[model samples]
Target: MNRNDRAIVALVTLGHAMVHTYELSIPIFVSVWLASPAFSADAATLGVVATVGYGLFGLGALPGGVLADTVGSKRLIVGCLLGMAGSFALLSVASSVWVVAVALCLWGIAASVYHPSGLSLISRGVEARGSAFAYHGMAGNVGIALGPLAATLLLLVLDWRGVALVLTLPAVLGAVLALRFDVDERAAVADGGTETDGGEEAGDSKADAVSSWPEFVAGSKRLFAGGFVVIFAIVVCSGLYYRGVLTFLPEILGDFPSLQPVEFGGRSLEPGRYVYAGMLMVGVVGQYVGGRLTDRVQPSRVLPFAFGLLGLLALAFVPLSSVGLLPVLALCGVLGVALFVVQPLYQAAVAEHTPAGTRGLSYGYTYLGVFGVGALGGTLAGGLLTYADVGVLFVVLAGIGLAGALASFVLGRRA
Candidate 1:
């Protein structure tokens, strides 16, 4: 990669990792919330409750996408980092579930802008798009795995509130780094033909201020009319499977006797939390592989295979949990790899189906599908786990994975 590509990738990589760090950390908190005396709520209630912040984390992508196009990505990304820091700070002092929900909403609104802004920047600025995405995704998976691991370790020494305070440091430092970076935000798009809004000049800087609602809607219409419609369904299915499987996975694993808490040095240690974090850590391999494949193969071609793997893994997750500790840990690792392999594939699919001009808007819609509509998976898993057995939950998850596979198969056929 050239200097410009390195700069752009570095910026997005930091921002992407920060976004997911907090995103995955919430589940670790959810497992705590279920057990904490501060919240007099059940898993189903907390699931629906967590969805409040999680939903906005997705639902706001539409407007965030619009802002990315209008105001430019760097500004939005900087604000996102700062806002996420503040949101977590608020969580540190929250006295009730209502406060927790409010803090999460703050987090959601702040984080909602990252995907559109960061991904759009990469799509528009980076020359080595696929490698940049791979590096970017690896960083995100790092956050995915480490965020929970960090939380688990911190919980050993600090209260959850103190842990919340510590999470703020990274974003604050990231925001400072974001402001210092000298990046060519439009290096890839400077070739022209990408900044037009209904024939007017829609430059990235404020002098031109690329703003047009009518154009946004028109662009959205064009995007969905093409292969993006199928792509949208595929991402939504991805979202459902992601949130459904991950939202309660830590708690679910705790149910297995094989993964029960161990007496270590006179203290009970929960191995399930580490297993949960390890599962996500293994996803780094998936992200790297998926990202490399995006450069060498058609993402649509890989989506079906990846999604099919996810379905099979989901179907087998519960059955294997009872086998033994090693088997269960092995299943979690495999499931994590299969689950994340679909991400870069679908992300690449978005770029392929849409134009560079509307890249932010397209990714906005993409995340909206994954996080917004997909936020329901948390509620779905919570409800199922409350009223049904682990068997039923996995069955539902398997069905979602199969559905995603089918959608991608159609998309691949179209491609």
Candidate 2:
């Protein structure tokens, strides 16, 4: 990678990690809160509270995308980082469930700004888009893996409040680093001076002003006319599948007989959390492989197979876990691979399907499908867990993945 590529990757990767860090940490907080003798919240009630935060995280994507397009991606990203840091800092002091809820909502709004801005940065700023996306996704997976682990570990030392406070430092540092090092998104686009694979100008560099509502509306109309709706549908299915499976993944892993608490240097370690984090860590490889594959092969071709395999893996996990710990762990590894392998593919797909000028807007809608709509997966999983069993939940997830696979197949032909 060149200097510019390195800068962009570092910026986006750190931002991506922070986003997942905040997201996954919430569940740890919930788990801790529930375990506390001082507080009482049933599983369903807690799910509702958590859902508010996650829902806003998704809901904020559109506006963030608009800001990325109009105001500039760098500004939005910087603001997002600071906002997230401040919100988490506030969360550290939260005493009541309502305060936590409000803090999470604030975090959600802040966290929502990331995807549209970061993805837009990759689409416009980096020349090696596939590699950049791969690195970015890998960083996010790292965050996803570490967030829970860190929270779990930190809880052993500090209170949840301290953990929240500590997490804020990274975002603050990230924001400062971004301000100092991350290039202006529009200027980067101008420097790269290339059209997206879909054949539109990177953006209007001459006009640094935000896009008007009329132009934004017209652009959306044109984007839909250009058939981005298909990509959007595929993303929604992917999001549902992703959220449904992962929201309860650690809980499911805890059910494994072999994954009991193990003592490590006098500290009791819950293997389930480690196992969960370890499995997700495997996605680093997936991101690398998937990112490279998109650069060489048609991302559309990769999508159907990836999503299809994901569905099959989801179906197999229950049966496999019934067999032995080894079998289940193997399944987890493969599932982890499958989980992240499609990110860069579909991210590449979004860029491929949408015009370069509107890449930020396109990513905004795409992530709205992934994160915004995907946030429902937590609620859906909680509902199923309440009324149904894990078997039914995996079945639903598998079905969602199958639908995404089919959509991807059609998308491949269309592309």
Best prediction by TM-score: 1
TM-score of each: 0.95, 0.93
RMSD of each: 3.2, 2.4
Residue 106 lDDT in model 2? Answer: 96
What lDDT, from 0 to 1, does candidate 1 have? 0.87
Question: What are the lDDT scores of the predictions, listed in order?
Answer: 0.87, 0.80
Residue-wise C-alpha lDDT for candidate 1, range 44-84, written one tens digit per residue: 99899888889999998878887887788888889999999
Q: What TM-score does structure 1 among the candidates reach?
A: 0.95
- Which ranges in model 1 have alpha carbons more than 4 Å from their true place? 194-210
Off by over 4 Å in 2: 182-184, 187-210, 262-268
